[model samples]
Target: MTQSKTWSQRFESALHPAIARFNASIGFDIELIEYDLTGSVAHAKMLAKTGIITPEEGDRLVEGLEQIRQEYREGKFVPGIDAEDVHFAVERRLTELVGDVGKKLHTARSRNDQVGTDTRLYLRDRICRIREKLRDFQGILLDLAESHIETLIPGYTHLQRAQPVSLAHHLLAYFEMAQRDWERLGEIYQRVNISPLGSGALAGTTFPIDRRYTAELLGFGGVYANSLDGVSDRDFAVEFLAAASLIMVHLSRLSEEMILWASEEFGFIRLTDSCATGSSIMPQKKNPDVPELVRGKTGRVFG
Candidate 1:
């Protein structure tokens, strides 16, 4: 990437590089490039439709954006530090490719809205993926349940055995737990699918922007009712993390049981060699490391 003018260059003083890098979000937000490009393309079409930019200019913007998207897909788009975030990085590259007309891409938007919209798009797609993987896990458990219908396992409460239960029943408890997680993700998606692109900065754009049109183009459920909340809201992210915490807790609880079952003192279950770890000095010691690691990850997620 060529040297591009920092947006802060207009201030007639350069920030200390460390401070600039500290404030930069590109390190993490680069993941937003694809969604950002998708939003830009949709916004460009809306701009042309609303007579904000010429149709020809909108075409050029789309073409340039597509090229950048291709570059990103091919791992050829490297963002410089001064670009601050993926939005600025892509815009700088777009301007270089299409000249001044690329400047008009931000005519009725701001980074606040752009980031909000990109995050929604990214998380919405991921929620679907999480649901799919979670369903697969349920199917695996159901298969195990089908095969172990008569295998008697002791049901425990407060670390005391209560009664003998079928292994199928034991596994189904977890199956039901995971099902709730799957349901929560679906609930989160309703709030995560709203578009926030027309909310310029914190308030909104002066130019007539058809928020509904942009939302439709992006396949969002609807536009945000409040412009300030559209850009500033972190509820979607917070709610996702909360849901994730529950999922992790469910996983950790299962892992704890498996870990206990794998112990020699319990001897109720034995993990396969592929997942178990053998101690360096103890030839008879096979550790349930995978379950232990899963248990550890719950703490990290909680933290």
Candidate 2:
């Protein structure tokens, strides 16, 4: 299938196949297609409002972008490696649908800023979902804690029993950890809510583009104060990852306790047949696979 190459004329020859594969980001960035479409619609509207592009052109661009979104949902518009990245993949398809008007969608913006805007928009949505999940998990923990209010359990320090403690108190400690994770997400959302569009690679654009208007359209709090920082700053991503790592740490710790408590030596917890796995040779074996895997996999999320 034929694909559009935005920089076809800039290079002296076609890139080597190995180099092209290395340069391609479509494999993963395709996940950002929905966010990219949202950003493009906001940008097109801002361009029209500022008299950079006519209202008719802006409407056409938005309509085409929405069509692309529908195509993606219906599994009709899949962009492979030839598209290079989600930005170009969407642009290529938009051009096919709306002709030259599609080309104007990139006016006064660079891929650098475009990707920044899309990633922030994506992260903002994900952070909200994660917060909701954390709330649900905390609710579950609260219910369990309430039911076990007076149940006694051995409190341990350094994996050695220290004293008898209420099981509800132990569960509440994890609830508190999850609460901090939720708060950290809220703080990260604030930093991610700023729009980075119109930065134009690394410098401010020459066009009289309205960055604030674009931000408002995209539901962002404001525009980045510095153009250079807007396009290049990935501190929000790093911060989110760091927060996520801590969340995983808390989860891993709880998993560790579950693993230990379910052991024959401790006998603090019993694993149901549905949640435990049986060993092939050991007829009496019932492994705590869920918590064991969770504890083992926690290291992957560490920033």
Candidate 3:
């Protein structure tokens, strides 16, 4: 059986369940557990190498963290409300698994630096994935262009048909925009790949930490030189948002063309029913809802 609760535990017990749930970021951020474990293991090894912690303790922590990672990957782990973020959740579980030694794993680091490192790593991976998706989307556009190399379509200016253009040319316009988006994502990836592990709190630690070691361990190309800059820098997040905005704008333009092409007034092409919807009242009305939603979502992305 569990031990009796302390006053703080009892106080937290009295809190509202919704408040508890709202405070728990585990639902979404639990995806960072593996990255957190990887960072911790690297930091622990660094600590041991620098004689900050015993080699025995470092090995124990590394083994325990790997076990926790396996638990999460194998779908055997269940994060509790008390486990705030992935960092806390992993540390708490580590303590449970290996006693006092697990607590020592955070000796030279703070949650600020840890979270910063984890988020950067996660974002870097996400940016790579998004680049791949953009490439595939670009390839689709290129293929469509090749297929319609000589097909003529009305080019619009201010929603009015102003001139004729080859369908291939119009499709290539989206390809060009997508290529730019891909380049932007790559640029953001470079900016976000800097390591933030050694920036403890808002300042550097007294311990002889090798930031470069942890950076290399985590596949970061380099470390943030200033501790304060490392902890407070969110330029990567802003760049990612900017990249997303451009991608959304390109998608919105394509969606607008799709909407126009599917309409009766400008029936240049037909969108398959799988990509459209039908009106509740008008039996003959087929709506390009997917493109409409994509176009509408562009505003949210812009905001």
Q: Best candidate per lDDT, number?
A: 2
Please provide, for model 2 over 102-170, each residue's C-alpha lDDT reduced to its tens digit, 9 standing for 90 to 100: 999999999899999999999999999999999999999999999999999999888888999999999
All candidates' TM-scores?
A: 0.94, 0.96, 0.89
Across 140-252, the per-residue lDDT of candidate 3 in tens digits comes to 98889999999998888888889999999999988889899999899889889999899999888999999998899889999988999999979899889889998998898
| Model 3, TM vs. native | 0.89
Which residue ranges in model 1 land beyond 4 Å of their true spot? 1-5
Root-mean-square deviation (CA) per prediction: 2.2, 1.8, 3.4
Q: Order candidates by TM-score, high to low.
A: 2, 1, 3
Scored against the true structure, residue 9 in model 1 reaches a CA lDDT of 52
Q: Which ten residues in a row have the lowest lDDT in candidate 1?
A: 1-10
Q: Which prediction has the highest TM-score against the true structure?
A: 2
C-alpha local distance difference test of each model = 0.91, 0.93, 0.87
lDDT of 1 by residue, 1-303 (tens): 233346655665667777777778889889889999999999999999999999999999999999999998898999977888889899989999999999999989887898899999999999999999899999999999999999998889898999999999999999998899999999999999999989999889789889999999999999899999999879999999899899999999999999889888777888899988888999999988888999898988787
Ranking the candidates on lDDT from highest down gives 2, 1, 3
